[model samples]
Target: MKTMNYSPEHLTSNRHLFWIAAVLGVIMMAPVAWIIGLSLKDNAELLKGTEAVFAMPYTLVNYANILESSSVFGWFINSMIVAIGQTIGVLLLSSLAGYAFARLEFPFRKTLFIIVLFGLAVPEQAVIIARHQMFNWFDLHNTHIGLILPNLSSAFGVFLMTQFFRAIPKEIDEAAMLDNASTFRIFWKVLLPLTLPAQATLGIFTFLQAWNDYWWPLISATKADMYTLTIGIASSQTNFAQSEGLGFLGAQAVFASLPVVIVYIFFQRHIVTAVSGGAVK
Candidate 1:
């Protein structure tokens, strides 16, 4: 077979696109790079200003100090419990509700779904007082359950799964029915397995939201021991700033962000496809 060569114009266009992407990548990563440099620096080097940001004689002392003094590990555990709990709850409830809304016929189904859609526009802050009062009444304040309750099932997740389920051919359900499969059986066995991309997308979104949630946790989990990673980091950063300097804060910040970055790296492809597929629908 003969090797085909690109035209000069095509080659030039490709080169231009490559440069543009490289520029954008650098712009995005510059701050993160700076943060990493700052985190690695000693207090003496940090005091020398921006010129010394990338200078040598870096040390891991900042990381060690934060790890030693702070209850970051406890915060990490609390956050993990809340995030994973919320993600699982959202996926389970959203998938079932979504399938029902998409496939099953029930009285007031449309009206109920319309109400759920209306929930999308309701800001979380609007119900803060009510939620707080309810949680207090149930004695759930400052607890992980309280933190996970509000996020258990989001309107967006329900809507997303509903749309995706609708896109699947109804014939599949009918065929399952003919095979003596019940409604729940059809959903669990036949339909849900095909919605992996949507599920992954929703799970990632839920986990990130729960992980980074600051305001609600701030209000609910007021006790220091109950604080999530975000809240703990903010509080700890202040103490670190006063005693250990900004380098310590940078190290803690990096530590706080590692889980989210790792999650995105692994599931980024599924996220893209889920978004684009939803858009195409």
Candidate 2:
């Protein structure tokens, strides 16, 4: 057995790092805390000034108003549908493409992967006009499919899944082959289960991206009935300049973020594992 000792200087360095991290954490959380505080305060009080956030007499009127709004509820449902739809699509397509790219031999495989990677460099704005025109031609506008379709073929998802799949040992596949397991079976039963961490990471990111997406939904879902949470929330803001509804705006921000927070709470362990590159054990 081996023993290790930490010197006074090492301890001092660790202490400094702890304080630095604590300060940075506080800096990052300050805006979130401010928003939450504002959401609890009265709109009129907030109109007087943001200083009311630090005072007493907090209320839930803002949240009450949000809950009572039927349009907000519809928007929330739209967001959920789009986010879940897109996440599942991205995961399925990306995993299949990744498995093919990593494990199968096919002509133009490398070239095709290179082209897909090129998509990562191409900003969405560059092709937005063409995409919109095509979608218009297909009459996909103002539809849930319109919002979900654009993100289904995810280049980043493909890249991440491919790398994760490649990191897995090929011997597993070879052994499965010896047992006459079909390719789809090998992938579905043997390999896919091992990639749970990567799937969790990809699913979380895809859901978050779809949930927060505003620009595409803003243009595509022009109708109020079709609006996602982001567009709906923005449209609900009666006035931004005068802070006419400051507390409501704050509440919307907080309300919209609750889903993401809940998701993190449920999957934080898998997220940590994926980030630490432990997907392959």
Among the numbered candidates, top lDDT falls to: 2
**Poorest stretch of ten by lDDT in candidate 1:** 272-281
Model 2 residue 223 lDDT score: 96
**Model 1 over residues 1-281: C-alpha lDDT tens digits?**
99767999989999999999999999999999988988988876666575677667789998998778658788988999999999999999999999999999999999999999999999999998998999999999989899999888599999999998999999999999999999999999999998887898899989999999999999999899998989987886656545767788788789889999999899888778766775215
* Number of colliding residue pairs in each model: 0, 0
Give the clashing pairs for model 2: none
lDDT of 1: 0.88
- How does candidate 2 score on lDDT? 0.91
Give Cα distance to truth, residue 179, candidate 2, Å: 3.2
CA lDDT of each candidate? 0.88, 0.91
